[model samples]
Target chain A: MKKLSETKEKRSNLSKRIWADRQLYFMLIPFLLFYVIFVYKPMWGLQVAFKDYNIFKGMSGSPWVGFENFKTIFGNPYFFRILRNTLLISTYSLIFSFPMPIILALLLNEVRIRKFKSLVQTCTYLPYFISTVVVAGMVTSFLAPSTGMVNLILAKLGFEKIYFLSKPEYFRTIFITQGIWQNAGYSSIVYIAALGGIDMELYDAAMVDGCGRWKQTLHVTLPGLLPTIVTLFIISVGNILNVGYEKIILLYQPATYETADVISTYVYRLGVEQANYGVSTAMGLFNSVVGFVFVYAANKISNKINGMGLW
Target chain B: MTMRTRGEKIFGIFNAILLTAIAMVCIYPFIYILAVSLSDAKSVNMGAVWLLPKGINLNSYSQIVHKEGIWTAYLNSFFYMFMGTAVSMALTTLGAYALSKKRLVGHRFLNLFVVFTMWFNAGMIPMYLNFKNMGMLDNRWAIIFGFAINTYNFVILRTYFANVPQALEEAAKIDGASDFKVLLKIYLPLAVPSLATVALFYAVERWNSYFWPMILLKSDSKIPLQVVLKKMVVDMSSRMDSLNYGRDMTGTSEDGFIYSTMVIAMIPMLILYPFIQRYFVKGVMVGSVKG
Candidate 1:
């Protein structure tokens, strides 16, 4: 009875303290309200994924049909194709585009002239800030079969013009290449900052041990950058399925859907364009669940391996 | 600097050449687009304009400027960018300031609540439906509020605010200043650099937003520049051959007109880029290191 009275006293003291800081709580109300209305409320709307939703019946009135939408999604023939395309594009990006920034950072580090290095960095980073709509426009104009610069060059060399954007086989290559072009320099900023953090004493020690420039880079520099590389790799793996669909939607046509259509775009088409809310939300929810699992697994693995992971 | 060996000298020279070539590859496409936009209709149609404009003309730019709906799109884009950034910065600053207080009740829970939104969201369709239900569809507020506060930017700003010395706030309090006064007089000035960085990020994001705006705003007059640019490019590319037959082939080809629209769309970013380049790099570094 005495312990219970002491606990009640502690609770009153805590409430008093909170009351004293009511101004701070007042300041936080708008932010909390924004999140509650904008972020959390929609999460409640995600329940439509499991329901047989009707436009007239609304969210609460819809009848629950558990797993039917998921079944239909799995049973559909286009599901695997889009799933394959999404994974293939993301994996290709991981394989091809991930290393380009590191390589560019390394190359930029080797530059002796400061002005030249900054110029190259600035020029390369410019494309990253350009709108995706403009980039898509440029891509189409540059690869246009009849009047594009690439086609013009090919004709000059006596080669037949290839319609690059329309061909399904070329979509992945174009997408990955554009990804590299747009992001390599911007992404390299992290590695460059990491490179600056490396101690100069290590380089001096390597030089004392008769290590050449290349040898010093190989032995000391790479080791110093290993942690950063590993951390970024884990994060990228977590986001492997969450590629931005805006650029793909802008660049793709009906002819290129065989390779270009990913889960996000497919969901957009079905849910928004066709008004098939239940199935699209089901697909979106599935994608998010898998993404959550991937992130969880990646974080756990990274923590176990290196004591570092995004929390 | 250490004395360079012969091999190091050779490597430096080779590196310079390679870096210059890479820079050219990065920049040449924009130059080509500019050239096509400025070239005569005949040269552009014949694909003769490569590295430079053969015949300079301003017809494409003039035509695009005089085009209906294009000006409204530009105006909408500017309004969205400025208004969205202002609201986002205010909300982010207030939230970060309040959450930065360690003694604030439920700070941890609030911070975690904000962070959770970063990893998980309601996805696109549900978000659209929610907005539709709120009567936000076909409204400019939909675009503005759709991306009101980027959780990543919020976290970074919160981290920045937390690092401000407690002595400053304590001094203000001892001087009979309230919490609001302390935030305005003490924290705001100290946090200017970080605030600028976050604002620049918000501005760029709002400027580049396409997906959310495309879904939310239905009216052509209210649509931003990107959606219109997309429609124009798609239409022009698909009907390229038809343009050569009977269209008034004057100073600019149909392709040149499309290129001009793209250039106009890109010019704002290109102009502001150099000014923001330093801050952008600093912002990214701060976010990555401390995030």
Candidate 2:
């Protein structure tokens, strides 16, 4: 009886505190309403993925389809192709683009002159600010077969001009290289900050042990950076399926769809252009489910291993 | 400079050369584009312009300035950037201020509610359908309210707000100041640096936004600068008729026109970048560290 009364008193106290801060509650209403309408509402609307949506009938009036949309998407040949392209592109980016920043950071850390170091950092970081549209524009112009600077250089070296953007095989390479060029410097900032936090005494001890510059880097710098590197890597892995389609849409043509088409772009084409809302939503739901699994698994594993997760 | 081994000396020289090369590689494309835009149409067509203009001319810039569509797009982008950033800052500030208070009822739950949106969403198609159903299609509000408050920016500002000295708030409370007044008189003033950083971020994001604007706005006049530039540079053939530059001007070549448009689109960012570059790095670090 005494325990029950104590609990009742605590509940009343909570309500009284809430009443005291009523203005704060008023301040929160707009944000709460925004999330309900914009974020959660669409999440609820995702049920149309399993329905036969009709334009006139609306979301509520759409007929239940019971996995038909998912079945159609799975059976379509384009499904596996785009899926493979997304994975390959993401993997290529992970492999080729991820390490450039660390290497750049290490190299920059080696520089002794402060002014030169800042200059290099600023120059390399500038590209990250350029708009994707402009970047894609520059890429197309530089790789244009007949008049592009790249082709011009190749011709002077006595090689046949290859249409870099048009060729399917070159698509992944171009994307990854551009990804590295655009982000490697900016991404290095985190690693560079990490490098600054390493103990000077550790380097001194390594020097006393007759370690060379490379050895010191290998033993001291790499280990110092390991936690940060692993944390960022796991985060990247969590986003494996979310290779942005904006750059792809800008850079790709119909001829290059074989290699460049990812799930996002495919969904955009179907849902927005072709107006196949049901199938497009189904594919998107599938991508989200897989992405959630990846993120959850990555977070769990990183937490177990390093005590650092994106939580 | 004091007692370095031969290996260290060699490494320094190599590092300097490599960094210089990397810097050049980063800046060369901008130079090339500027050169092409300034060169004569015939020179650009023959690919004679390499790193510098050949027979310098302002014909391409003049042509772009004369185009009605580009100006409309430019005006639309400015409106979106300013209006969107204002709404975003207002919403984010109010939300962050409320959530920053540990004593606020259900603050933990509200924080989690906002943060959860970052991890999962309805994805693209469902969102499109939702917006379409709401009659936001071809509407600027679709772009504006579609991304009113980035959850990451919310978290950054909340973190900053949380760090404001508790004594400051307590003193204001002792003086019988209301929560809104405390926020206005104390917190907002103290958090100007962070607010400016986040505002710049929102501004740049709105300026560069294309995909959402492309999907949301159907009419050519309502499209933002990035989308307009894409139409000109990438889908050149399809949009050429819509451009209506006339057959006479077309004889001079469209390459110069495209390059000039790109340069124009890039000008705002390049101009603002140096002044805000320091804050950009700092803001990104704040997000990364706390994120």
Top candidate on lDDT is 2
Off by over 4 Å in 2: A1-5, B237-252
Residues B44-85 of candidate 2: C-alpha lDDT, one tens digit per residue: 767688889999999989988898999899899898999999
Clashing pairs in 2: none
lDDT tens digits, residues A1-311, model 2? 99999999999999999997887788888877778888899999899899999989989899999999999999999998999999999998999899999999999999988999999998999898888998888988787766778877887899987667777999989888888889999999989988999999999998889888889999999999999899899989999999978899987877789999999999999999999999999999999999989988888888877888777
DockQ of 1: 0.59
After TM-score superposition, the amount by which residue B76's alpha carbon in candidate 2 deviates from its true location, in angstroms, is 1.0
Return the lDDT, model 1, position A170. Answer: 97
Clashing residue pairs in candidate 1 are: none
**Tens digits of per-residue lDDT for model 1 on A1-311?**
99999999999999998987787888888778889888899999999999999989999999999999999999999999899999999999999999988988898999877998999999889889888888888888888777777877887899977778878999999999988888888999989888889999999999989888889889998998888899889989998889779989888888889999999999999999999999999999999989988888887887877777766
Q: Chain B, model 1, TM-score against the native? A: 0.93
Tens digits of lDDT, candidate 1, B130-228: 998898999998787767889878877888888888888888788899888888888889888888889888888888878888888899989998888
Candidate fnat values, all: 0.66, 0.63
Models 1 onward score TM values of 0.96, 0.96
For each candidate, what's the DockQ? 0.59, 0.52
**Candidate 1 CAPRI grade:** medium
